[model samples]
Target: MHMNTYSEATTSQLPIPPTMDEDLENNTEVCDGNNAMTPMVRKKSELVVVANNNSRLQMLRNFMTNLQEVFFGTKLVVLFPAVPLAVVANFYSFGRPWIFAFSLLGLAPLAERVSFLTEQIAYFTGPTVGGLLNATCGNATEMIIALLALHQNKVHVVKLSLLGSILSNLLLVLGSSLLCGGLANLKREQRYDRKQADVNSLLLLLGLLCHLLPLLFKYALGGGDHSIATSTLQLSRASSVVMLLAYAAYIFFQLKTHRKLFDAQEVDDDEEKAVIGFWSAFTWLVGMTLVISLLSEYVVGTIEAASDSWGISVSFISIILLPIVGNAAEHAGSIIFAYKNKLDISLGVAMGSATQISMFVVPLSVVVAWIMGIRMDLDFSLLETGCLAFTIIITAFTLQDGTSHYMKGVILTLCYIVIGACFFVLKTPLIGQSPKASFGVKPSFEAITT
Candidate 1:
């Protein structure tokens, strides 16, 4: 009987003890092929071991099942699983610039996954960590594209894209968010903390001013004289360094000194409500970043080709198309939050991203160019500078009252459209073009630079 029990436990895939109970050993014997006797466990002892083994196995299986449910449960897993297929598609279509571009666009959703994971992590870590992570990764796509463009000495494209990013965030994304949120809450006014929003807008205005200084220095003293150009470049490099320091201080003010000012809610709760585990969030962030980097390379490689083939200016490509592509994540998040009536978070996404691009990413590009010996100056064209200044001031004006209506969104969006159209017709930039040589109109230095 004891032998039978041991045999049943073995066949049932339960772990068996090395030795059986002494009572069973005294009572029972097992025989090998040569009729050699071996000690066997008693039936009761074998049953006890089997029961414990089954319990352990059951617990492990349950744990695995839960893990599988959690990890693969999200609808986003559908996209994650397609990443391998996208990679293969990109490789197979390597020679076709259009196909490569299409594949790169497809990879954008995967990059957006990083944003979702960051939000999840933030939910658990609190708003500060979450906001910081979002800010860092928010422009990952743009930063990657700019750095790659810088590597190829495509400084013009980089500058255009930087302005494009800021405009897209300020006008397109923010406008859409406000419209959606206001419409969704049409019965009541959609409001955000004007005070917090104004701080960022002020910072944006400061950044825009800093950007204009290089241009002012160049044109104010006369056209890009070799010595003046040299001075402007040096000044730009210095300004970029200072801007980076200022950005650090701004972050300190927002996250440390006056976090409550930016908090979406009055409660100071630190409880984490995110469902994603730490390991899972970290893994996804790293993986998605790699994918975005690869996709950005393909996008940059094809940008000029696409622009030429489409008969669109490279500036237009960078200013409009590239910003839309790179900012896909934030654009989606902003609209989604707006639809959900989370206007505060929605506004934060738009305003905060715009501010970061202006203060942090733009300055970093200048510093990176200086480091790489690329003669990148912040002397934007008059049209570009004027558009930016006008947009920032108008946006600041809209935010001042703390209330957003769908009509206001329409107005902001219309302004963006007009500006985009002007850029579309803007002349392809000359290497040393005067400020007067712009899109059909020539504004004085005061109007253009200031």
Candidate 2:
């Protein structure tokens, strides 16, 4: 389909037949009395391009909209620089400790819960009405959470945020979807793409490996208890590099052989049947992120001031708390979609975003921290590392059962619970120390130091 880029909208001497609507069959529209406007024809491969979509004015308008989301995100908490400034400025501020403690306890959980709730509604609709809607909402939720986590300088928590989401989507969401949907098809048990699933499954497997490898490296070096700096870099670099390769493979495989993964995307045929008003959902997503970001900054600032006084390790903060905040919406959405029989969408949520976070978010965070002169490491401890591997192995094994059941769902949920326990149970391995008694920071340092 060659498009004429001619200046004139209409000409009698035009060589090709007009693409404009030639019939009154269904009230197809004409733009500027020329090109046709089929606003509601839905298909699998294309978008409902508003006749004005290519016009300078419309482009400008949409660009403005997108700018609003970005600016709004930035201004909400000055997400990038705010926390570090707050941390540094604590030196000159009075009552800094009090300020930090109250702010964190009030802010982090509440903002994340909002995102989780908003996304849960969106997810309940499934791909039938809100597949793309859910994905967009998930991104929105993530942005809101990430911005807050970033502002707080809760680096480890943000990482856990990513991890929790990956685990939830991969295991619980996917498992539940397959279980319910597969049972629904008990007559014959319809199967989806095997080759694609196999490849995606591999990528997901590797992504989990990237996450876990960091922990293993840290442990091999006598645990995070030793302050040997190079070890952290080793974990970060290895995870980023391998995970990146796995992701690239996923994209290539998807584009080349398994285009159906994106089959649910809006197109010309189903245009009329589609009901999602994406822009509205996007707005809500952005709005939620803004509020969350503001709250997260305060949360981080307070946490820093209060951490030692509160007798908690920042490690515990990151590994357990951060993941819950960042991925709350995604976890809910994936589970709901699965329960509704939209298993493919569930897979997309789990595998696609898992890859995206491992390849994109982790590296980007590292780069951003570097630019900000933060010395955060994209590494993990052996315990945290083992959880990553456990998630991957369990997810793969469960899915490979070739039939979804409640048992699979139970397995996934249990993994999540066990991992959560580690946050409060496992003692933090500090540099120049050995693994000691189980966690529960004493008023004196004796418990951990021993």
Choose the strongest candidate by lDDT.
Answer: 1
lDDT of 1 by residue, 16-92 (tens): 54566865665555424224422234566888999999999987886675456444654445545445554665677
Error in Å for residue 236 of model 1: 1.0
Q: Which ten residues in a row have the lowest lDDT in candidate 1?
A: 31-40
Which ranges in model 2 have alpha carbons more than 4 Å from their true place? Answer: 1-154, 175-196, 208-228, 231-235, 238-242, 245-249, 252-257, 264-285, 304-322, 427-450
Query: Worst lDDT window (10 residues) for model 2?
Result: 434-443
Candidate number with greatest TM-score: 1
Score candidate 1 by lDDT.
0.76
Clashing pairs in 1: 124-272
Q: Distance from true position, residue 203, model 2, in Å? A: 2.0
Q: What global local distance difference test value does model 2 have?
A: 0.53
lDDT of 2 by residue, 1-450 (tens): 134534454553568754445555234444423342343334322443544455767768766765454334322233333334444455566465555544344333334344343433444454323433444445444445555566556566566556555655565556555655555655654344344355656776666556555545554554334465566665666566566565566556555555565654322333333222345445555565565555556555555456577676655555455445455445555565656555555666666565566565666666565556665555544455567678777766766644455556666766676766666565554422334222232223453632
